[model samples]
Target: MSTEGSVSNDREGHVKTEGERSFWGRLANWGLYQTLMTVITLSPRRQFFILAAFPILWLLTQHLGPMLQMLRVSLLDAYPVAPDVAQEFSLESYFKFFGDPIFWMPLFRTLIFAAVFTLCTLLITYPVAYFLARHVSRKNQMLLLLILLIPFWVGEIVRTYAIMILLGNTGALNLALKWLGLIDRPIPFMYTSFSMGLGMVYLTALYMLLPLYSALEKLPKSYNEAAADLGAGAWSRFRKITLPLTIEGISSGSTLVFLISTGFYATPVLLGGPSTTVFAETIAGFFHVAGDEWPTGAAFAVIMFIVALLITGVFQRLMKSLRKGESS
Candidate 1:
């Protein structure tokens, strides 16, 4: 009887073990997850390609696809051609931009605004980035960065409205000035170039700050210390050592801010008066008109894109040369 009971107990233990294995095995072998696991285990290169496929496809479909479509439309005489009508392509849309002088001022204005705003953003954020990277403790650095980022978490429109509220006649700034007896009446800060510029700088500050901070953080403290030991003053060390080292960050941040500033429509419209209309606002006007005007808008957009790229290319070459000079 004892022998029989021991044999039965062994059989029961084997069944339980098999049951647990079967349950886990089913989960591991489920559908696409199993296929992915198999590829990952068998071929690392194949695994990488599989992982990268989605983003590559998304870029092709979402970004490149739209640009190509826009380019095609820009060459056409008219978009949304009737079923009975033959699709005719021409350079008229593009010609419209070059032939007219009315469009010139806004384009020039946009470029100038973008350049100024980019510089302002860089100047303002550099000190903050330096302080955070050099003075703040490592344990609390992330917390401070998070606090800075919280404002950007909201939509651009919301943030623009917040700026509107702050700069309006009866807003915080004016009220504060009045309270301090600096002015008897509220300053008309709204719908002006200053207000628009202020909004642009506020919006693009993060783009400049993060790159500067990243570059500053990766920089070795020993270099600054060594320079100081050699009797270099703070300004001398910063001008010679710190500035040269972080040129790449400055270029990256400036480029991003400039590109973003050129494309702003809503903020400029809301904050700017008639004199401050940007090329983006002009481009938007074309789109807001009849469908026939879409091709014109597309053409103008392409012109702006090409011009911006040309400017950016020149800027990048300058930055590259500067980097080479620093390294040498």
Candidate 2:
């Protein structure tokens, strides 16, 4: 009787243990299912904010910190005359930049040069980009692209020097021209606006080309085919369809080229005369060559930054408007 009782006790213990385990398993499954549902039900906007938080924090720390520091420096009365001494906070530098024609004139010249260069870059690069995107065979396209990129292998400074050599009074082009009796005297090509523009164009041509090519490449060939089928001539198809599709690229390339060209110092200094001084040169002169006026340099830098921001904002709005019009 005792043995039978012992066997029954063992069986009861085993059943109780299984019941406890099943209860815990059901609890665990319920918690896991609830978690999954919560995750699935999260709003996309909330998720995006969560995902973007770290990157936004990082960017703020990187960019805002330096900008604040620069602004503080600009606000202080600093001069190069006494390198070791610090002056009280003053608006002298900002006033100097605004009140002085030397600073303002160069800034104006810089704007004009950048605008002219941007226009020339667009005019020259658009046709080349269109041809490459639409006309060339795949095999030849690759080869031509390689050729276009070959000039970039050389450094910008080296290329500028090369331009100097080719355009200098006694340079190869001048020698050839003399041999051909094109001119009796060698031309003074270096240290001129023409040379400055040429160098700027050469350095920035690729910038314009890549964006334009990408824009043109994204255009549907079907549009052109349909236009042709509808008795539209080649020029008409290009004017109506191809040009409209590539405006974004043109705007993007122009903005980039203009911004870079505006801030250009080395090319202008090397190739341009005194009359062709750019804003960047003025900033450099204030900081290093003329006198170490940190506040003045900072003021100029701030103004340039604001101008660039304005240009970029305008371009973005224009692009958006164009896209909306196209969609409509």
Give the top-scoring candidate (TM-score).
1
C-alpha lDDT score of every prediction, in listed order: 0.90, 0.84
Steric clash count of candidate 1: 0
Question: TM-scores, in order shown?
Answer: 0.85, 0.77
Candidate 2 regions with alpha-carbon error over 4 angstroms: 1-58, 79-87, 289-292, 319-328
TM-score of 2: 0.77
Instruction: Give the per-residue lDDT digits (tens) of candidate 2, residues 41-85.
Output: 598887787779889998888879788766777777764437567
Winning candidate number (lDDT): 1
User: What lDDT tens digits, residue by residue, belong to model 1 across residues 1-328?
Assistant: 9878856765565487753345344556578877878867677788788889999999999989999999999999889787889989999988888787778789999999999999999999999999999999998999999999999887878889999999999999999999999999999999988999999998999999999999999999999999999999999999889998998899889989999999999999999999899999999998888888889899889989999988988998899898788768
Tell me the lDDT of candidate 1.
0.90
For model 1, name the residue pairs that clash.
Answer: none
lDDT, model 1, position 176: 98
By summed lDDT, the worst window of 10 consecutive residues in model 1 runs over: 18-27
Off by over 4 Å in 1: 1-24, 27-57
